[model samples]
Target: MSQPPLVEMIGIEKHFGGVRAVDHVSLDLFPGEVVGVLGHNGAGKSCLMRILAGAMIPNAGEIRVNGSPVSFADPNDAREAGIETIYQTLALADHLDAPSNLFLGRELKTRLGNLDDARMLAESRKVLARLNPNFKNLQDPVSSLSGGQRQVIAIARAIYFDTRVLIMDEPTAALGPSETAMVANLIRQLQSEGIGILLVSHDMHDVFDLCDRVVVMNKGRLVGAHRIDEVTKDDVLSLIVKGELPADWTARNLEAAQ
Candidate 1:
């Protein structure tokens, strides 16, 4: 906890027309830590993360990577700063093979200026193996893969580029229990590799299970943040629905009241 945060968004603000999508929200992410961002459908969580991901420019605020202030004009700039986002859509090219999808834009080229299919396949194999050892259908198009496999491909694309801070939006949204477990294991592996992750999910189980700390947002404002061990699920739910933590929620306060 003494180490400086890997990424910091300070006094972030965004507005669309007359509505404020985000209002002076600040958040920090440290290395090898998973921080969950929870909010309702229109609570501005996605908008906040989009600003971090460089998909949307904030009307006001500053972003710092590794304590250095940086500006992202687009997603490429964020990627260059070691930031990557995997949205709920996954964004894989359905017709492309796993290797192709992995190296979709930033393809590895041979010395002769040809597409490096061999190397791409090998690299894909390595990264995919690290994420999912059971995965084997590299030649098949991503559209043919299972939900979990597709999720793996999306994640593989993100981490393959030495991603330092990952923004995952609804990572386990539509997966079966087994597939959800697979993604959870992958998240743990990423954490072990010292990646800072911002997990935006509505699933309480995913938040509690995968996050080291959880922050709640409501009506375009931050409600509060707490260590996962310091609060119960109902406590977080209260924050989500009520836009604030319950009075006497903390252990110390509860003991005092008792």
Candidate 2:
């Protein structure tokens, strides 16, 4: 805990016309930790993350990475800062193979400036192996892969570029139990590698199981933040629904339940 946070969003605010999408929100993500951003559909969690990802510019407030202030004009800026976002869409070209997708825009080239298929394949294999050893369909189109495999491809692409802060939105959405488990294991591995993760999820189980801490947002404002062991699922649910912590909420309440 002595180490400084890897990413900090202080007094972040975003407005859509007269509507406030994010209101004076502040968040911190430490190295090797997973912080869940929980909220209903319109609670501004996604907007806040998008700003950090450089997908959207915040109307006000400042973002700090490794204690230095930064401004992102676009997603590429964020990528250069070692921040990557994996949305639910996965964003893969259906016809492209794993290696092609891994280096879609930033393809490696030979000295003569020709596409380097062999080198790209080798690099893809290395990163994918670190994520999923069982994966062997390197030549297969990503559309043919399972949901979990596709998720791996998306995640692999992010980390292959030396991502330091990862924002995953509904990472395990629509996956079966085994696939979800695979993603969970991947998350733990990334954490072990000292990557800071900001997880946005609607599934209580996924948040509780994977996150070290949880922060809730409601009506464009922060409602509550708690450690995983200090709050129950119902406590988070109350914050999401009522826009505030429960009246009698306390860390001891969770200990008593156990």
Candidate 3:
């Protein structure tokens, strides 16, 4: 028998006053899967991810986590459901150090409710060392770190927290090639630990290289979903532009898109 999906979004719909921002789109994300959602600026891909992250409420449709229905009132609701998002801006406080940023708004505390300084620093150090070996001194101000270093801190914060489902929005946008590559490596590490990932990116290479599956959106509707092993980069691009599968989708993908 097939495994139950970690997340299932059925007939998800959202509107902005008179405009429909997300149409009847549905998606199933498997455990330990890296699923990419891609499309043009107005395709509603971000809207969908925002909804999945519980940043917005869909006008219609059902969202399921481990097959149980969910109503996400906000991002915190999604986080409680094991979903965490790293926005394009990353939302890190540049003035804070790595450990401070990691524990922002959710600090570790002792039984007496005193801030657990020793435990938080030691634990953050451990997780950071594993992912970015060069990282040291979690107390240094983030302004002193490189772009990739800051991104690493953001990703590490999500992973350190028990985030089972990670949502990354345009993670490498406007970064240098080296910075982007660093983010890619971080993603691979997250997947190795069986975290389900939803990656929203503008780079095709990032999508093709990092994701197990691709879900395309266009003009507020789902165009197609392509398994990375069964489709080409060009075919995924076609779906992004044309709002449908390319003529050459594998038989299985064609059936799935239909």
Best by TM-score: 1
Alpha carbon lDDT of residue 210, candidate 1?
95
Model 3: lDDT equals: 0.86
User: Per-residue alpha-carbon lDDT of model 3 for 105-166, expressed as tens digits?
Assistant: 78999999998878889988998887678888679889898877787788777778778889
lDDT of 2 by residue, 146-169 (tens): 887888889899888988999998
Question: Which tens-of-lDDT digit does each residue in 91-166 have in candidate 1?
Answer: 8999999999999878999999999999999999999998789999999998999988998889889989989999
User: After superposing candidate 3, which stretches have Cα over 4 Å from the reference?
Assistant: 247-258
Residue 222 alpha-carbon offset, candidate 1, angstroms: 0.8
- Regions more than 4 Å wrong, model 2: 253-258
Q: Name the TM-score of candidate 3.
A: 0.88
TM-score quality measure for candidate 2? 0.91
How high is the CA lDDT of each candidate model?
0.92, 0.92, 0.86
Candidate 2: give the clashing pairs: none
Determine the backbone clash count of candidate 1.
0
Error of 3 at 196 (Å): 1.4
Residue 95 accuracy (lDDT) in model 1: 94
Which regions of candidate 1 fall more than 4 Å away from where they truly are?
251-258
User: Residue pairs in steric clash, candidate 3?
Assistant: none
